[model samples]
Target: MPPGVVSMAEALANVNPDALHSTQTGYVLPEPALFVTSTLQRQRMFLHHWKLLADGFLYMLGQEPQLLRPQDWRAVLEGKMSGYGRTAGLQELIRPALALCDIQTIQGLPVPVDALPQFSLRATQEIIWEVADTSFRFEFCALDKRASGKQWVAAGWAAMALDERHRYVLRTAALMLDWTTHCTRSNTIHRVADRCPWPPSEMQALETAVCEYYTTAFYEYFGRAAVIPMRLDHDAEMEDMEDGEI
Candidate 1:
């Protein structure tokens, strides 16, 4: 709340405690996991995804295709092809995806991933997206069992929700690189043509190569159901099921 820094207490306060427990049926991080960061990283991650999601939402609205709940549809954004990394333990997996997009830009801060709050959905995306965007040098620690494949590929369907500019692909590329901390602790491979998420007609051109350029370093970190998916109701209005009173 102080300028760019948003506390876990403040971020979690936005969600209903009940919803948090209910949504995380499979895997949920233990309490006291807060991803603190500079105001700049926080703001950077928030605005970057906000603009992307906003654009995707508007594009989908105009296309009038059957839409998926933000959570369900967002899952396609997860998985290995997207460059989402996996750690051996639960705690390490939940670490914040840091910002390495700009090494010079992030001169004083520790990696942004360390400070990400678990339940803030938008915040998580900010973490991942920022990690993807920031261009930095050096490597990050790993969980275990690193991958040999040194390439990257963004999951195909994950980008379906996005626009033609392949914003999600670019963001996913950034995520794979930053999430794995330059492949020090994780084994994220960037294989082209293997993770195509577009229609057949859209394939065979730059789109094919474009889709292969990104990968998910870790999906569950950002898509945990505990962080209630932002809901869109019948009236075309944004509804918060965890409206604080719940």
Candidate 2:
């Protein structure tokens, strides 16, 4: 045995087989005294032991159906293990049964949607918003107070008006915000915002360039920015990047 691995016999001994059996099959199958350990190796041993128990349960159902009863088999097949209920852990134990029998294709037993993990739209939106807000704040600090205040107001309105359905557009805007913020922070040639003499038109041009760069990034990440609605489009100065334009 490896340093971090336990044997199947050892794992089976620690846990009550009756409890394990009851969790898997409605009826208490069998119990025997066993040894147990609290090591990472025990996880491997546990999985292997579970495989043996699942195999034996199926075999019993085939040979002595009367002993197990039909409802008990139905509960197992439907992922409704006794004490475990219909949890992911129980589902893992029953994977063999799911594979052996085409439980999915069978008329009434649809797989549970929550059984699989999925990416969340809300979480993605929150990330985009964080990136956008950070970028806006960083860039706003580079301008004179009056212009900075106006830009701050505009940025806040833009963030507030952002539509949940247009996350891709929000992502593009965030990328542009990051680019402008980085450029402003790194430009040592100009005096700091309080003393800098850069005019409003120059600042506006810089913002325009950032928007252009954002369009290129958007096209590279997603095939086309035009797929997003016209109302959400910000880079009006540049032509839309068609498919394969990158």
Candidate 3:
């Protein structure tokens, strides 16, 4: 009931004990998984199961994408990317993408990504969209010989859904008014972009996608709507899954 934090007991109380196991058939069941942060710890069990498909047809011989760069995505989910790191606010979050796009701004603009947020939004777009699709629910249930590739894809959306700061900044960016974005300190400025890089609907969709997967994860792992402590055997299973040996 708190503003930001949801305790495990509160999270559990929301889940229906008698709900059908939806992992087998997907989470189209009546009782949906609670969309809260309580799944944060439990979801780690399937952190290895996250992934994406490139161009909708880039999957080769059924091989999934590799998690080449997971540092930024991992750091935030683990609560490591919040404070000042080289740049203040969320500038650190979008710094890597800036380099990729060759878009150089001042040394430390208050929110460089704020001006054109797509540079940051594109970081997690395709992969999150894929994993959230119902098709991969079973794939996550199975892992190939390479599993690390999908971590960042899942991590990208999880950061948006789970981290308070990350979600707040993203939602704020989406709600920015046209005048607000174009204005100077005092007077209104000339025209900016005809439209923002990305739309608010994208933010809503990302949250919806992750929240659905968050619920599906509970059913897939716990076999019930409940989220309890994962056992040692499950931990070992997750370790093995991470190695793509599963």
Best-fitting candidate, measured by TM-score? 3
How high is the lDDT of residue 245 in model 3? 24
- CA deviation > 4 Å runs, candidate 1: 1-166, 181-189, 192-246
Q: Please state the error at residue 17 of candidate 2 in Å.
A: 62
lDDT of each: 0.28, 0.31, 0.29
Model number with the top lDDT: 2
lDDT of 3 by residue, 1-246 (tens): 112123323444444435434333222111112212265342332221122112222232134322212333333223333456632543443434344444354333223222322211222222233333332233333221012222222221122234363454333222221111111111111111233443545544443332333343444343544222111212222432323222
TM-score of each predicted structure versus truth: 0.19, 0.18, 0.20
Model 1, position 51: C-alpha lDDT score: 34
Write the number of the candidate with greater TM-score, choosing between 1 and 2. 1
Residue-pair clashes, model 1? 35
Winner of 2 and 3 under TM-score: 3
> Candidate 3: minimum summed lDDT over ten consecutive residues — where?
181-190
